[model samples]
Target: MNANGPVTAPPTTGPPEHPARAEIDAEENLLEKRRRLVLRRLKQFLGMAVAGTLLLLLNDLLLVHSSAAPSLVVTLGVFFTALCLSYQGRARASLILLITGVLATVGVVLWLEQGIRDSAAVMAMTFPVVVSAMAGSRPLFFTTTALAALVLMAVALGDITGLHPHHVRPVRLSALISLEVVMLAVGASIALIARDLRHALHDAYQQAASAREARRQMEALAFLDPLTGLPNRAAMAQHFEREAARASRDQRRLGVFFLDLDNFKTVNDSLGHPAGDALLRQVAEALLSVVRKGDVVSRIGGDEFMVLVPDLQSDLDVPALADKLVKRLTQPFHVDGASVTATCSLGIALYPDDGHDFAELVKRADTAMYHAKNAGRNALRLFNEDMNSNVVEHLHLLNGMRQALEHGRFELHYQPQINIRNGDIVGCEALLRWREPGLGLIPPSRFIPAAEKSGLIVEIGTWVLQEACRQIKRWDDAGLPGITVAVNLSSVQFKRGDIEQVILNALDSARLTANRLELELTESLLIEDSERFSGLLKRLNELGLTFSIDDFGTGYSNLGYLNRFDVDRLKIDRSFVHDICTDTHHQTIVRAVVQIAGSLGMAVIAEGVEDQATADKLLELGCELGQGWLWSPALAADDYAAYVRQQGRAAPA
Candidate 1:
């Protein structure tokens, strides 16, 4: 199943029954064998013909007193030498020599001695028919047979008149007629047999060819993707292995890229699968067009492809190539009469640099690809040592998160959100903090994204919502000042279509009023289709639950949604706040956001106020609510309760 070796279909040549080469090669072998068989038999028969003719000439010279013996012997010797010396494997040359030797020796003796009355000369003509039959050529057999009959008839006419050299007796005339009739019957039969044999060979070759074609089709199915007409993962694996070895031997660089189409599932879900398929085909063609002739591009799985860059000039050039390929793939594709653009993230690893072998290289490339996706899609990353360590850390964090959730090793910290005008802790954002068994106090930044990507965010987010609700309800029952407790929700949670139910369940189980709980969602969440998500927001709002737009002014926002939906507050992103004191643009954006909120009759909260100057500017800007280290860092539930009690007591009565 690991196809990282040579996957190209090799040219086939050999016997028909070879499992790899199949029937075409076998048919070729059969033809060669037949040709060699005919050549060998023809040589042996020619030697016999020469020896037989010499014996006949010697008999005529020593005993029969045949005057044509000398000329016939000389001609037969010359033709026999030519046949033995010149006919290598050419059946045509052998056949021609056979006919020439037979006619010259037989005709000379027949005309010089008894013409058509000579039985020996007539018998000598039959050898050529046998040789021609064995050559497996029907046309040659028929031609040789017809030539022998014509010569015999010519001799008969010469013997008919007194002008003939030998006298034709009536007793001998009937015997010569019988011999000629038998020769014609034998020659005709051999020709018919050769013709049938040729047909049978032709039929067999055709059958073998058909079977080979079928096998080739099966191989194509096994190794290629039908939709893209590209090699599959199995083929890619095979190609990688072979190229790796060749690269090592030749001291060449080989680059392997792990590529994944970004947001392809959204296209499939929004459009139809047929559109997605057409888009994939277009992508494959684009990728192939951008790569080198020696490079291989394969579709390993859904929305995932690999490009094997063999014979690279240098490992340093891989990034440039990868970038070019990514750019090519991101071009707009016209599918189903609609213009659609899909980008890809690629991770590249070179042979002997990232890994010495296929598996190792692919693993590194895959790791790097994940990093590229995390960094943001439509990019490429070359494998590095840090990526490996990050991979290890990510895996450790992912595994630890699962166990932490199960054993209640995770806890929530409350960061106080104070009313800037009155200096009262109006509410607190419930932030998640993890304390692993050994690794203490893991930040939300480190594991939150990982959890979301791994789909553990759904469970983790649910726990956060429920635990925060329960803790706040306990605070209320203990007679402490009640404040709105906000739990941040990941965009992934909303995708489940059951986020509203989850929120209701947490509030009901905690016996807390819906109005006391606030759910925070990022600006990206609002960027989604308003019609699809607006209903859920309205339903949640009907339950007296409120919402805040978190990390505002950091992403593309349809600011109209703030008013269209029941948004109560906007938390200015920390990036703008961190630089607001120094950067005019940040200050202007903050002022604009505050103005926009005030016009819409919504509360605005600014976070990351580390100093009094920044806090004073927010107050001057009409921002009412804010939280930062200026108050205190986020605290555990018990610590937060103590802090709240302490702050209440210190307030002037």
Candidate 2:
């Protein structure tokens, strides 16, 4: 399987070179080397054969004038047959046949002439040994050498015993000994040289193999994710370039899907890093399973993956792929005997439509992915121009917020929480408001998300806590009625910021009671790590601080945590309260919350109550406290102070 593509099949080979192809190439190279060796030896043999045949013909017809024609013709026939065998690729057989024929011809000449005393016949015996050595076969070279020695010994014995009818000259012992010594030296020298050549060839092949392996490993390290074995960002970029070029040439669409696992950090924190790694690997598998064969799936670091879908027939094909990914990823993954369910937010960008380059496409896809996350995770969003505008605005807002935090342009507004039955201002929820120099008052909805995303919310939340405490002290100094001041806590502040320390510092510096400062936390934040948060809540509760679930019923309203943490209040979110007077669904939710809160000995406060009828309905539903336009919108510090004083004077004791 290719790392650049889907990993549904087990990897049989890596990139750049497949094992089977490399093996075939190596086999072909070896065969070519053998072919060259055989051809070179055959050429040498052919030259020697031609020269020997001509010399024999000349000695028989022009010089010696003996009838050696039959012997010469037999030699020619043997040479032709060897040449035919070599051409048919039977190199070893041809070599053996050629050596045998040369030995037979030389032995016959020695017997017919002076036997052991024939100088030319003894010299001719060296041909078979030399040819075998040239063939690079150690066994064949040694065998031919031994055969030549036996042939010499036989010729000497036959001559000495008068077994050769044609032997007329007596063999000289010194001449025979000198010839045997020369043949032995030549054969040994040739054998040693052949052995050295083989060793050098072996070493060269080994070095080449090592270099190839090193290059393959380097490529794997550069392109593949260590954990998931998927193509990483660098490989993805290369794949994108190739796919993009093809799409442009073919006039086809290419979709880039950027995937981010929702609440992945929570998974790491809850399941530990090992389990998180396992989860990521499983996610990679699921992604590969969803994509087509040619599509590319890459792990772009830290729970983020990119899928490049090429050769898209039409835009209609994109959503089906995206939906498949979302559905497949949202399913439960079993890791270390634990069933962990993960949902991914996917953002898609099309080639030549959303972006023209890899980086631009990825950026746009990332922006769209964040939009999917913001639209509530486990969804897919296609890249659009408006998302880019929103992204630009978000960047501007993020930058502005950073500046505002540094320049002290951020402030809090107090919205009065009224008692539904007595019309008394029971408490006021602190709302964060930003006043930029030229932009006027920037609403929380527009900038709060940007702040949260940029991690400025932690510092900003600290400021809100400190400022709310100071204002509460200022109101007490002004001799106003003592009421709880509720400040909203961001999940980021709770997780990353030292909330307990910041709260303690604020209350201590302002000399305000902790109970008078209520921390409004969302249900999702509380349920994230309940056991850890339970301990923190317990510690804060011991410090005489009050805790309320803000924007209740808008999240996973798990009552198990409410009882576990012992929360003091549940602030009903404005959505249900806005239509509680008429919408039966909203009314039912309110009633359920009121009943649940009442059973748990917790106070329920309704937010976004705008009229007397809504307030009356909340009161009728057993909710006594309400905060909305019914009493007053969130006001400035001075306005809230004046409003409190007026409410105190107007109320009958």
Candidate 3:
């Protein structure tokens, strides 16, 4: 089909994009059709009601009029009026009009029956008045006029032949003229009022219609997310519940895709939140282009979207649509005058295969999405039950891990950072390890994301900090060495301003010096509330605590703000270290950071060292220290302490 305007997207397939409209024209069309239908019904009802009332009154009025011809005219007028009211598309008020027509016909017949004797009577004046003014309805009024003329001919013919002019004299034409003036004035006034009432009724119906439309719009807005214009979690749940029942009844296939934007936070941090929101809106529009009718899309997370597609008979179509969505979203997004490409990771789950219920399917989809990100993003993953063994087992491990923390089931393992030249143990970074009753060693990374999401990090982080402080204090008490302990903080914990108090509580609890503890933070932490964070950093510095920038190369780095915040060290991310010796660009960046740190009177440490050449190159390049698998792949707390003692014994201090 031909599209209006040059179509920016491929026109042949998928859903249409809605440019935010003042009115949803498609829904408006449905409402307009319904409204007109309702008006037609109302008019038909109005015609019937008025016509019924007039028919009932006809026989009673005709009995007084006496003349069979006049009574016959009255009865016929009422019957026709009732028939017209019963016809389709007649309004109730139109029935009132039918009544008016019956009245006019009756009046004309009465005048004819009374002859010239009663011409001066109200009924005679009324007959002519009604005949002249009932012209609004051409067919009925004309028929009444023609019949009235016949009745007038019969009456005039009878009067000319009457032998005795008992009830009448030579007809007074002047009196008839006076009666005509009064009747015309009365009829015009009644017609004017009726016309005014019709206009008022039309206005009322229009206002009622406008109110109904506004109500629907308000309801729509309530169920939709303002940012994305997609259904929210509440709306999605409602829709899913309804669709699930329908699908179950029909035995159709249902699919849910949980989509998460990859590296979205990095974009938000680097470009500012305004740009991030624009990116989200653009992504919403992009997703809209991939959903068909009978499908729903919802925003369930800050950067996550849920899509529900139903009424499929087979799984073949589900994958194809999911593939289409991934392709469409993985394409570039132009936002805020910048052409930035963003990739969405899709986790697909089908009914009965992935889950038997709505929430279960969504959960499985989420699990698949988590794996998608870990397996490298910009891809789609179908949820598999066999994979759930690993995930379900992993969740069990995580839950056990949390319980262990609650009952002190975890312990700290520290690795020392040695002074290579002097062979002295300076400080150790504290790592967490879980020894389950059945399973073996579990790493921090295996459960940390879950910890952060579950708000368990606060508890785990506190334990690590306090335990590391106690270890430092124990080493000092044994007269082994003066060394510092570095503790990693999660983003959630760091945002807690009372983290200083937590540190102090640990210090006081362990009876350790503040100078011997160093706090480590990554580049991602720098994105929110920089000024407030800088204040916290300075405050901690004043309390005799030191700060280090951890995993520096992985985030948006502003070298301009180093000395301003009194940072003591920069830890290079391991990604750059993997190719530093071979890649000139990588080496240049490392060298520049090393020199910049040196200039700022701060130390630099490169993490993830695996070979001697890289270590030699870093020392040659004026790097302060190195840590990673090349030296050791993390050791137990006791092993680290012994290594520190043995190395300190060999140093020529």
Candidate 4:
């Protein structure tokens, strides 16, 4: 019920009509037409009955001078009275009375009237045949015509025998016979016309029924998946809106379950698309069977199904229901005479919890389903706040990083590398940094993950290389001693076949020598695709460019690559150097790295050498290069240039 009394259904727009409903509608229309026809005929009969009764009473009391007047009068009055009575309830009964009245009037006129030839009585007796035709009944028309024929025969016998005063000579009898023949022809015509009318009505009814059924089929095809007979994604979206509204009104939880079939591609690959389609249909049926009455299971697209549970008693109910579905869907199904088993990964999101709207809920549920697949197939997971937070933050970072690239929000800091023997300045490593306007100085750690995840690292890393080379050229032109500037390369950038082109463009644009610019890479980058990495390194090395493995001892320390490739130096990871003076493990690893560098004809640079003791230990261990807070932390470009000039003045030229 709505705010009004009983709720009324909205009028149907068109098609997809239920077969039973269509039949009921057609029957109701037929019944209504019949009711109206019956009522019309009954009124017409009542008018004829009233008028005939008055005309009979007047003729018997004044006009007619016959011995049968009273009998005819009584019969007409009785017949009229019966018609009026039957008209109150039964229309068919009133029609019967009218037919009987015509027969009775003809019989009375012929038997009682004397010497009545060419009288109006014969014409009046034909009224029943006309009335029967008007009533659209072939049975009544034929019955009245037969009865009238018998009456004519009786009148002809009466005239010949003089049993009544009415008699006809042969010449007048011929005219009367002609009149009977014309009336019979007219009755036959009316019967034939009525039969044709009935056939036309039936044909029209059948056509209307067929058209309605075709419309219903078209509507079903639009919203339903033809193969599986399940509501499609479009229909599911509509269902979600309606169910969400209802859940909001009742303050109930609505659970959206996103299900994806596992190993379905294997079926398509091995058996054929026909078998895969059959498997999808079986899965749809299984899901439909397990859901409650109010729940809707829809085939979203290809091997994926969405179930919307509109009302739940508690949030806890979602897991048990999901488990039941997973168990049921995992059972073996027969397709193309072969038994196959498939599993589903399900992710659930609740109304007013995971999301308040349809799209959000679907996305979250899809994400959770992906997590379930990652965890292992044939499992279920519910969306949690942690997932939402992480996804939202990642999205924010990706957007911000794009904006930062276009607007010149990035900065580069250079850390000076020094010689452990003479404390002489050699070269500095350029590091990329970002300082968002409002957020202020976002470290590389904060934004690098976003860049890497979005594949923006390639573009950003290219910019870093170009800027680092350009800075090195500016410092060299400023009367500072020529120093090699090392720029770190992201694994994504290093793997591209165009890396050498990007490097040459940067060096040419900055007007710097290849040896003065070194490319730094991590051990993992080399280990990922070593053959490709080695070929790329060889090509760049042939161009007079230098290469170093950055943050060594932290990743796969494959020493064989150092011997196979033309590498110059190793920047020891800060993890070992930060505690080198105190941790014995750090001392031992540093000694091993220095020995390996000697064996491979490479120089070793100790990074994060923060104290005099760590520096002294590196020099004693035959590692001649180092950089840390002990010398100076990484500084802005201009500040590093000032530090470089000061260091040059301090050195013994």
Candidate 5:
């Protein structure tokens, strides 16, 4: 018993619920007790029948009375009938009747015999114990032995009190009590042994169940990624190999996507580690929110997740997935007290075209992701070598632009932000143009997207902010104009948390009012960290700095989301403007974009107005501003200022 101390009948702590399992276990326990109760009653009844027979034999041997023989015989007949009934069923009622008959007969026989130690009455005392053991009920055997002992003691005490005296001598009384004690002691020992065996069996079953539960928990832990509760690398790889094999045999297309969160580390740095972890979980949920039941999403590494699309075909169905994922990520996430914003760049590598093997497919997807990161954050790009060459050239340009930023080859040009109705210059977007000593007058598009990819836009954008501030300060000093200089924001620049501080730094340096500088972003930029990005915009927006989304229709084009953002103008994309004069389809699209922007109280600027026809049509369509080669392409800072001066002289009042 010292194995854990006296195996204290393990407390039934039950289970942890208001609806405990005790009632259930207890009901099973009661059933067994009731079954034993029936067995016990039958054993007692059989014992009584045996006693009645033995008593009749002794009474016949001692007396020559036919009356006593018939009385004993009648008692025997009654007990025999009871034993038959008890053996068949109704053990409780039949056995109780047998017990009452035995006690009364024993007392009456003793009084008639003057308390002699007769075989007749003594037989009744042994019958219950002997028959209980024969019937295989150890508890009943011990209980019967105890009851017999008590009955013998009562007879002995009755004799002493002279009330229905049946005891004759001290020796007879001592002998009967001694026999009863011996029988009880032996029977109780057997019962104690049986109870111990039953308890040991119960303990073994519980231990086996506990071990099985522990095993299941360990197996689950092996598959789970602890932080996000998504599948880990090993589980994901095993799934990949299984699905890849199935797809190969079935001739189904498989899509492997490598998703990297854009600038997630910035949130970790700014908001502390706990907030970062919460943000990551929120992102994981958003990524999988629309996933169907059979699809799988896994966290492969820090800030990188992998998706396996097992059955796919690349028509309208497959190409549509990339656009939907991009849209899902643009919605702002709220965690803790902060409304966090995040975006993911998706890179796709199709089966067989990318690779027949898992490792090869993953590598190609990784290669595609590098190209997507080169394009900009919040964008998706498929794997192709031609895409990489352009990606390589763009990165090279940014590396050169970094060197140029330090040596000073960057210059800004001002293009008029004009009123379409009057054709008067209202404000100007300060555009950057480069004149490298080796290459003359390089365009902004070739270098700007590169600057964004390389994260050099934050610095270059800061330069533009300060330059525009300085120029507007100069114009005010000359009393030539007091107008806003709208500057374009690259996506990378939009990601910076310190964008407001960058503007504040510029405004303080150049001594220009915050009201005179406007920040413009593409609609694609609106799709990233809008909570963080929009907060930065609103801070500047609150300072009277204007906000506009450039290339509006070229983005995901969710006009519903556009109304939720803080902006002053929506610049109609140049692609639409280029074809609006020729294509009726393009005209319809332009009209829709213009109507939506105007309905939201955001002024529409028509970009790429290369001829009078395009500008006149934009004005006819009720656009508020136009900018393109119709007037001038982006120019050098000094040259544009001198040209503006010359244009003012050429103007007729």
Candidate 6:
């Protein structure tokens, strides 16, 4: 393994919350608290008023002469009116009425009775202060307390100055002064306690607000992707649950689309990770723009996104929506001043039809996504029952491959690459084949793709390279003519495996010279990171090892890389050679490849030549090298050695 350090995702901060909304919520809470307090106080005042009215009526009936009857009647009227106002939801009006009525009644009773010496005077002075405190108004509390103190002092001064001559008992100055001191002391103490309680209440509200904000932020971080600022997988699951309930209730359909970008790794490798991150952000924004307002787009992880579309009227709507998404994403994005183009493979699974649960639907959709990628990217596929069987088979194949590798069930077969003019074996391509105990002679097509997808190709490719080198040395030691052995390299091995080190170690262990080994690479690999690959290819070339582009015309056919890299040979794909004698297009393609190879000082080899006519046509096109069934099919190591020996005796020296 290459064993490079892990790449960490960049850090992102949570979005800022709206301050105005928080302030509004806090204000509403305070108002609700004050309303409840006022209502409770009003009920208490109403109860006391009913009891006092009955007592006053009894007193009026018992007394021979009573001067307080009018004041008592007025107090009863004011209390009833305040009750009616409070019941009508006019809390402020009711509180104002109660305060005014209390002050007027207390002033009249003080004048009519024993002035400051009356016990009613003390109740009158403190009632407004208590009510103001309950109302949670600091200014009103202090103002009411000041007015109560002034009334007490005024009454004391009046009694001392003999302003009221109708007193039943003469009041003493020491007693009046003591009463004034006691009332002031009590009022000041109430004010201090109310002030402390208000401060504590304000602090408590602030702390609660802070706690709420913190919890909100934590929820955001838990459910959001930091890089794309979209909903993450956890959020998608929660959203699915909610949407599933709604869809079930309404008898509607829900669509789950699994989307993955194609060739995203090339961007990360060539342009750097920052550009890749920028491209992902642009992709997220574009998906958001194309989806409906109610639809959800979530970033599952790294270049893979899942979209949830609910309230679908019909299953037919999915294809149209998928096309729209594909068209939007396929457009070029400008990242880091480079115009980059990307395509997506989308897989769709519908609720109630594909599966009822989220996990099952996602799995099916993911399977479909791989199908779309396999067919060719920038396309969409719908989940089917047949795909499920394929998934099960794939799992079995992966397990079997692992067991096969561990138990040495894998072996290489060498196919001779023939010289067209001389009819002699020059080199052979090593092809891997698996022969399980139950399933004998498993083809490369069956397991190679699985291995590549599962990342087992790197280990498998390592084994192939080592074995080919050792086999070549054995052939040399056996006194056979020295012929090079070519091994195909998977892109996975080139990128993730320490290929150079593995090759060097294999050569050293086998005692094989570098020139006897040939590496066959795909065209896509050469153009991925040309600069880095150029340096690596140059180093490998300096060691006398050679490279050939395998299946050349099937992939990226840019001629620039032919000159840029240290490529020695071009292997024309079998598709062109299969019908070369009959198809004019195939002949033209082969002829062009031959000319290009000759111009670049490279060799051309046509694969899949089946008969004499095809081989003769290839020779006319100036391609002197060939390999196919016309020569010999791929054989085991021992069979290949015998075949080479037989061909050697047949060749004219």
TM-score of every model? 0.52, 0.53, 0.52, 0.46, 0.43, 0.54
Regions of model 1 farther than 4 Å from truth? 1-206, 217-239, 242-354, 359-387, 496-498, 578-585, 611-613, 648-653
lDDT of 1 by residue, 385-441 (tens): 563455445544655676688799999999888877777888889999999866789
For every candidate structure, what is the RMSD over all alpha carbons to the true structure, in angstroms? 15.9, 16.2, 17.1, 20.5, 15.6, 17.3
Q: What are the per-residue Cα lDDT tens digits for candidate 2 across 407-485?
A: 9999889998888999887788899999999789989998786666555688789999899989888877877647568
RMSD versus native structure for model 3:
17.1
Q: Model 6, 1-653: lDDT tens per residue?
A: 01111123457568766889977987999778757766865656555554554455455546423566688688778878888888888877887777666667767767776776676456645766676676677887787778777777776777788775437555544335434543553455456556658976887898889889988998988988878878889999999999999999999878899999997899989999989998988888878877766789889999999999988874335654665687688789999899988889988787867888999999988998999899778767778745344534554465567567779999999999888998977788999999999679999998787677656688789999998988887877886648788899998898878899999999999987888899999999988889988998899999999999999899989789998988999999999998888999999999999999999999999989899999999999999999999989999989988998877733211
Ranking by TM-score: 6, 2, 1, 3, 4, 5
Each prediction's whole-model lDDT (CA) = 0.77, 0.80, 0.67, 0.76, 0.67, 0.79
When 1 and 4 are scored with TM-score, the better candidate is 1
- Itemize residue pairs with steric clashes in candidate 6: none
Worst 10 residues of 5 by lDDT: 1-10
- Residues 10-64 of candidate 3 have per-residue lDDT tens digits of 2246564564553477568756754454344334433433443243235325433
| Candidate 6, position 71, lDDT | 82
Candidate 4 local distance difference test against the native: 0.76
- On residues 270-316, what C-alpha lDDT tens digit does candidate 4 reach at each position? 99998998788788778876777778887788889998887777533
Candidate scoring better on lDDT of 1 and 5: 1
Candidate 4 has a TM-score of: 0.46
Each candidate structure's count of clashing pairs: 12, 0, 10, 4, 1, 0
Worst 10 residues of 2 by lDDT: 1-10
